[model samples]
Target: MKVFVLGTGGWGIALAMLLHHNGHAVTSWTFFQEECDLLHRERANEKLLPGVRIPEGITVTTDMSGAAEADLVVMAVPSFAVASTAEQLSRIVPAGTVIVNVGKGLDSQHGYCRFSETIDRAMGGRNPVVALTGPTHAEEVARGVPTAIVAASASRAAAELTQAAFMNDTFFRVYTSSDLVGCELGGAFKNIIALGAGISDGLGLGDNSKAAFMTRGLTEIARLGVTLGAKQETFAGLSGVGDLIVTCCSMHSRNRRAGILIGQGKTAQEAMQEVGATVEGYYATEAGYRLAQQQGVSMPITEAMYEVLYNGLSAKEAIRMLLGRPRRGEHEEVWFH
Candidate 1:
């Protein structure tokens, strides 16, 4: 299969390497000539993905035209860039091309819609959009570490096709799901929770506080997801709780790192600048807060996140707000006889 990856970020380059290893001809597209030149000249993205070498078999370029010939097109750009990239590909890639979106975040520009919806609308519904997401991180996946992910789409054929293209028994594993909404929501909302976890760590909170924050944060995520028509079971799967755990706990998660800085007294903007990478949780927090309000869902953690990230509330105050909320049942649905 000929695969075209539509970004040069760490995740994009990592997937390109994985596909090339799977015996597919891979081409990576970037918007900037300088990044293209760097990848072409060095065969490695040392800054974003340190120590991982890009094989010679993969072609790197700034041209979007190469995507026209791809059997599979991976939307590896950041969530903010997905719409623009999809619009660009609409003029290039043929109809029915299977688009695999590896980025995990909602479309803030389109009512916080899933990336698949954003892509589908951009392409005039000409292509099948599959969200390939989970707990897997670029740094780990690029190094060929054991990683499992999901390929979700409304169309089972598209999901299965993506599964076949990326799955292997060794280090990379892929699962298929028909619940695209659940999968995408899980992947996107978890980043906000990860920010809270990092903030807890930065505040020198112990394991008990972090664990409670993660648990309640997940409840908030699930409440919104179910309100938006996603399956309740999906939150328990790899894309939901699974992705949440890894993102909150791992050093490679930019969202958590940024939250740590914010918790340590830096503002959200300051933390993002210091992190020097796209901390997706920042954007997600804004979108999630809006979505929760529009849907009338109770997402206290997300609301607190919004206060810290946008409303000028301090991180410590946000934590205090979360802790001071009126006590409630662990499971809202549970009843005592």
Candidate 2:
């Protein structure tokens, strides 16, 4: 298969390498000529994926026309760029081209719609969009670490096709799902929780506090996911708690890293600048908060994160607000019963 990975970030470069290794003719696209030149000249992006080499077989370019010939287009750009990239692809790729969205996060510009939906809408619903997401971090995956990820779509054939394109016996494994909503929501919401977990870590709050935050954070994630037409069981799958665990725990997670800095007394802006990468959780926090409000779902962790990230609520005070909430049972359903 001819694959065009439309982004030159760590995740994009890593997947481009993986596809090249899978025997696909791969081309990676970047918006900036400097990035394309760097990748073409050096065959490596040291700042993003240190020590991971981009194979010479993969072509890196700034042109979008190459995507027109691609059998599969991997949308690996950041969430903020998904709409424009999809729009660009709409004019280039033929109708029915299979697009696999590896970028995670809701589209804040479009009422926090899922990336799959955002891409589909941008393309005038001409393409079959599949969301490929899970706990796989770019840092680990770039080094050929073993991990399982899911390819989710409303169309089973599209999902399975994506499964076949990316799955390999050694290192990368792929599973398919019809629960696209669940998968996308899980992928996006986990980052928000990771921020809170990072805050806990920054404050030197022990394992107990972090664990509590994770558990409750998942509950909030599930609550909003289910409210928005996602399956409850899907939240237990790889894209859900699995992604949450990895993002909240791993140092490679920019969201958690930024949260740590914020917890350590730096402003959110300051932390983002220091991290020097797109801290997705900062955007996701706002989107998640607004989504919860519009849906009337109870997501206390998301709310606290929103307050801390956007409204000047200190991290410690956010923790206090969460801990001081009215007493409630672990499960709202059980409490009512």
Expressed as tens digits, the lDDT of each residue in 229-260 for candidate 2 is: 99998889999999999999999999999989
Q: Ten residues in a row with the worst lDDT in model 1?
A: 327-336
> Candidate 2's error at 134, in angstroms?
0.3
- Residue clash pairs of candidate 1: none
lDDT for model 2: 0.91
Q: After superposition, how far is residue 308 of candidate 2 from its true place, in Å?
A: 1.1
Q: For candidate 2, list the clashing residue pairs, or say none.
A: none
lDDT for every model?
0.91, 0.91
TM-score of 1: 0.98
